[model samples]
Target chain A: AQTIHQWPVAEIKAVGSPLSLGCTIKGKSSPNLYWYWQATGGTLQQLFYSITVGQVESVVQLNLSASRPKDDQFILSTEKLLLSHSGFYLCAWTTNSDYTFGSGTRLLVI
Target chain B: AQSVTQPDARVTVSEGASLQLRCKYSSSVTPYLFWYVQYPRQGLQLLLKYYSGDPVVQGVNGFEAEFSKSNSSFHLRKASVHWSDSAVYFCAVSYRGSALGRLHFGAGTQLIVIP
Candidate 1:
């Protein structure tokens, strides 16, 4: 069975603090990975997507960067967290058509 | 460019009543359609999908959606609702054919099942 796991289910930090969110997919190899952000009560916005290890494409600019160091691991990070960055972050993996999403990480920037 | 539209921001319905959520889409070509449900604070779960076929697809929990290319609409339906069915429903479209593609999601409709 395929499963997607996200680390640090929730986070609270200062405005300038650094942040890192991770996602991993098990039982699937070389799958496409994507990052999405959703506001408290808004629709989802695509951030970045990776087709393979060491290659990622940015769909939008939100002052965030993503990396796929391993085939099944994706990391989203930033040097400074802004108040506007507080929301729900989700990771998704897809190959053919159907996309499966991770549980998500809730971040609150104080 | 592809986009999805879900007109209703929120819907309130009584338990045991039939449900309908409307969706409209715009794409240059035929796309893969899907319905997903999200709990209060959880990831999205696929309710059903429409690739290319009978125009009506059945999903889990007795949920179904009809696809109409002429109207560019995909409407979700349920025979009866339960209190546990209260959640946010989203309609998405993808244009990838045997390849990698990003999903375009609608604003989403919040379903409130009143007991």
Candidate 2:
């Protein structure tokens, strides 16, 4: 089975501060990677997806950017944060089969 | 374009009562359907998937979903739901013959089971 790990379970930052989130997948090579955002008790919205390294696609521009540095690692970063950017961010991996989601990081922008 | 619709935004039922959550999709070809459960503050977990096999498929925790091509629906059903079954359900669809498996998810239906 494939396992995905995400760092910094929770985060609180100021509006102008920079932010970064990390995700790593094990046991699956070159799998499809995705970024999603969700509010409390709300539905999930896809943010980005990457099929291979150095390639990323944006679904919704919440002033966040995604990058696939390595085959097993995906990173979400922003130079500055917005108050509306506060939400739960999730990382997932799929291989033409079922998807495995990370635990997710709860973000609060003050 | 492929999209999913979860008709009921919220559903409430008593324990031991039969449960059904409706999910409909719009696609031109035969779409691959999936049902997932998300516990409070947790990530989505796969409950079941329907591809080319039997129209009815069983999943973990006594959950089953049936696929209907004519209606373009994949409805989840359970004979008797438990309190533990209370969670948000998401319906996803993938393009037929799709090797990428990028899923388009529905807004999700919130299920509440009373004890």
Candidate 3:
């Protein structure tokens, strides 16, 4: 079975501070990866997607960038966080028919 | 543009009652449709999917959804609702033969099951 693990289950950071969130896929290689952001009680917005290592596409620009450094590793980060950046971050990978989501990481920018 | 619309933001139902959550989509052609459930503060779980086949598709926990091509709608239904079924449900659509599998999600509908 495939599993996705996201790091720093939750984070509370100060505005303008650097932020890094990661997602690692186990038991799958070269899978299409995606990053999504959800407000406290809002729908999800696709932030970025990567088809292969070192190639990421930005869907909605929220001052965030993503990178797939390795075949199974995806990283979402920013040089400085903004108060508006606080939300739930989700990582997902897709098979031919459906996508599987990770547990996700909660972020709070104060 | 491909998109999904979930009309209800919140729905309340008595436990063991029949349940239906409506979804409508706008796309040039019939896309891959799906329903997903999310427990509070958790990632989503696939409830059901409709690609190409019978209009009705069965999913986990005795849940099912009917895809209507003419109406451009995919509505989720359950025979009986449990208190544990209280959660937010999302409708998603993906383009046919999309290798990237990028999905467009609807504004989720929160289901409140009263026991």
The best candidate in terms of DockQ: 3
- Model 1 bad stretches (over 4 Å): B98-100
Q: What does the lDDT come to for candidate 2?
A: 0.90
CA-lDDT, candidates in order: 0.93, 0.90, 0.94
Under the 3 Å rule for N, CA and C atoms, how many clashes does model 3 have?
Answer: 0
Q: Which residue pairs come into collision in candidate 2?
A: none
Residues forming the 10-long window of minimal summed lDDT in candidate 3 chain A: A94-103
lDDT of 1: 0.93
Candidate 3 lDDT score at position B5:
98
Ranking by TM-score: 3, 1, 2
User: Which residue ranges in model 3 land beyond 4 Å of their true spot?
Assistant: none
lDDT of 1 by residue, B1-115 (tens): 7899999999999999999999999987878999999999998899999999899999999999999999999999999999999999999998856344788889999999999
Candidate 2 chain B least-lDDT 10 residues = B94-103
Model 1 Cα interface RMS deviation (Å): 1.1
Runs of candidate 2 exceeding 4 Å displacement: B97-100
- Give me the displacement of residue A18 in model 1, in angstroms: 0.5
Q: Write the residue-wise lDDT of candidate 2 on B23-83 in tens digits.
A: 9999888788889898987778999998788999999999999999999999999999999
